[model samples]
Target: MIQTHRKKAGFQHAGLLLMLLPGVVFVFIFSYIPLYGILLAFKNYNYSMGIWGSPWAGLEHFRTFLTNPDFFRLMRNTLLLNIYSLLFYFPMPIVLAILLYEVRGRFFKRFVQTVSYVPHFLSTVAIVTLMGVLLSPESGIVNLILKSTGAEPIYFMAKPEWFRTLYIGSTIWQNAGFSAIIYLAALSSIDTEQYDAAYIDGASRLQRIRYISLPGIGPTIIIMLLLRLGDLLELGFEKAFLMQNPLTYDTSDVVSTYVYRVGLMGGEFSYATAVGIFNMVLSLILIGIFNQISRKASSVSLW
Candidate 1:
């Protein structure tokens, strides 16, 4: 009887494994398989030699990346960009969602949300082009206004000082409303009874929001923050690369753009791969640190 029970348990475990087959296969193919390519970071890669045949270079690639003159500038730019993004992009969505949640008129709230989210659907190329046209030094709307006021036209895209502002501002404008949808969903899940109690206790609108709504969605916020921390090093290459030029390189050149230049343009595959691995390890460290902090302080963690 015991042998029969064990056989039945084994069959059940096999059934469960079959149910997970697709997901397991997907991760194995896409994630684990690609990890093998990380070996290129330590090798002198050549087109003729291929990945496996490339000669090992020990820590040469890493040494070159770390000692390069541009290393500090690239690291500083990337770090500051992400820090600014975290300061601005991280909180705006939550604030927007809270404001929307407080609105009494459902139609007006939806209309505002719909209009705001429209920017997120626009192609990045189209958005950048529009920005250039609007901020052009000569005939652009912003410059035209400046000219009317007898102030000089600011060459925003070309100026190093403006790059971080433009990039982070554009991201906020494009993503805030769309990103708020998840927060809004979290807000919707809050218990209506809690709000009713607060109201009965003579709590003001702001008070109820402060004590009830904010705390209610705190876990969602913590989770999103953890995820963002995990992606701290991964700024979008398309937008930054398109907007950057030699003049703005001081502020705009980041890890992704550097990797693209070395790997695709300069044909320095090993150096680029090494830099990429460095970024990944840095990101992993930041994620682990923040996850630990979140678990300790807020009792919310992805793991």
Candidate 2:
């Protein structure tokens, strides 16, 4: 009987492993296989000779990127944009999730959730195009309304000062509802008995939220903030590139966009790769510092 049980358990474990096989294969193919490209960062890559055969450049590329005049500008833009995102975009989902939790009607809640998250599925190109159409100086409905109100038409996408506002606001709109999914899941797991106890003690709705609800989701908030910190320097290329024009480069230009222009377009592969490594290192350092503070303060951390 013992021998039979061991054999049955082994088969069950094997079946579970089989279910994970596809995901493991996918990660290996898409993620790990591409890691070989990191070697190009240290070499003056030549297409004719290939990556391995390319002449070694050592820290020459790194030095060049560090010494470049545009380096600080690109870094500043990237950091500031991410900072703005944290300040403005981060709180939005938490607030949305709390609001969603308070909704009393099932159908209205479901409808609102669906509508809010649907924009997340739209392509970035589509979102940028929609912004262009909706904010056009002369023809856009927004500008038309402004003009009718005796105000001057504003070219939102063309102005450097408005770039951060548009970018961050659009990001919040596109992502807040989708991001609330995790918080909602976390909130749902809060014990009902805690709320019951708070209510029986004659606590107000806000008091219950302060004492029970916020504490329940506190760890989730910290983890999400840490994750954001991990990607501090990785402002995505596509949306910024799509929204960017020659006029807005002062504010909109970020490391990823600069990398595309200088590395891919200009064929400075080693230098661009060096810049990427620097950004990665910087992000790592930031996340490490923040994680340490969080761990000390709250006893929760990614590590």
Candidate 3:
């Protein structure tokens, strides 16, 4: 009987592994196989010689990036943009999830969720184009409204001061609802009997949320936060690149955009690769530090 049980367990495990096979193969192809390109960071990459045959530059590229006049500005913009997102945008999904969970009407809740998620599916280029049209100084609806109100038209996209605000605001609008899905799933897993017990004890809706819903999704929140931290330096290049103009580079320039300009446009492959490696190292260190803190404080971590 024991042998039969072991065989059954083995079959079940085999089935589970089979189900996971595609994802494993996909990561191996797309993620692990591309890791060899990191060698370009240490090499003086030559198009003719290729990555493997390129002359080794040791720490030359890293030193050049570190000593560049714009290094501080690049770091400042990247850090501030991500920090603002963490403070303002990170809580939006959690708040949305809790509010959605509290909605008793199924249809209305579904409608709201669908509407909120629509923006996430929109392409970044499309979103940036929409922003440009809406905020155009000459003929935009926004400027027309401002003119009617006796206010001057502001060139939002070109203004350095407005870059971070627009980026973070658009990010929240695009992603909050979709991100909330995880929290909603976590909330759904909480025992319904606990909620019933709280209600029977005369707990208010807010009280129930505070005591039950929040706690139920707390681990998911921590895990998501850690993941976000892991990508702290890894901002989306497309939207930032699309939204920014030369005038806004003071505030809009980030590591990713800089890499694109240097590597792709200027053909400084080795220098760009070094800068990217630095960004990756910082992100790994950040996630490691936060993971440790989370584990010590809440006994939850990514590791």
Best by TM-score: 2
Residue 119 C-alpha lDDT in model 3 = 96
CA lDDT scores, all candidates in order: 0.93, 0.93, 0.94
lDDT of 1 by residue, 8-66 (tens): 99997997889899999999999999999899998999889999998999889999989
Q: Where does candidate 3 stray beyond 4 Å? A: 1-22
Off by over 4 Å in 1: 1-26
Q: Each prediction's TM-score against the native?
A: 0.92, 0.95, 0.93
- Top candidate by lDDT: 3
- Writing each residue's lDDT as its tens digit, candidate 3 over 38-65 gives 8999999999999989999999999999
Ranking by lDDT: 3, 1, 2
What lDDT score is found at residue 217 in candidate 2? 100
TM-score of predicted model 1? Answer: 0.92
lDDT for 300 (candidate 2): 100
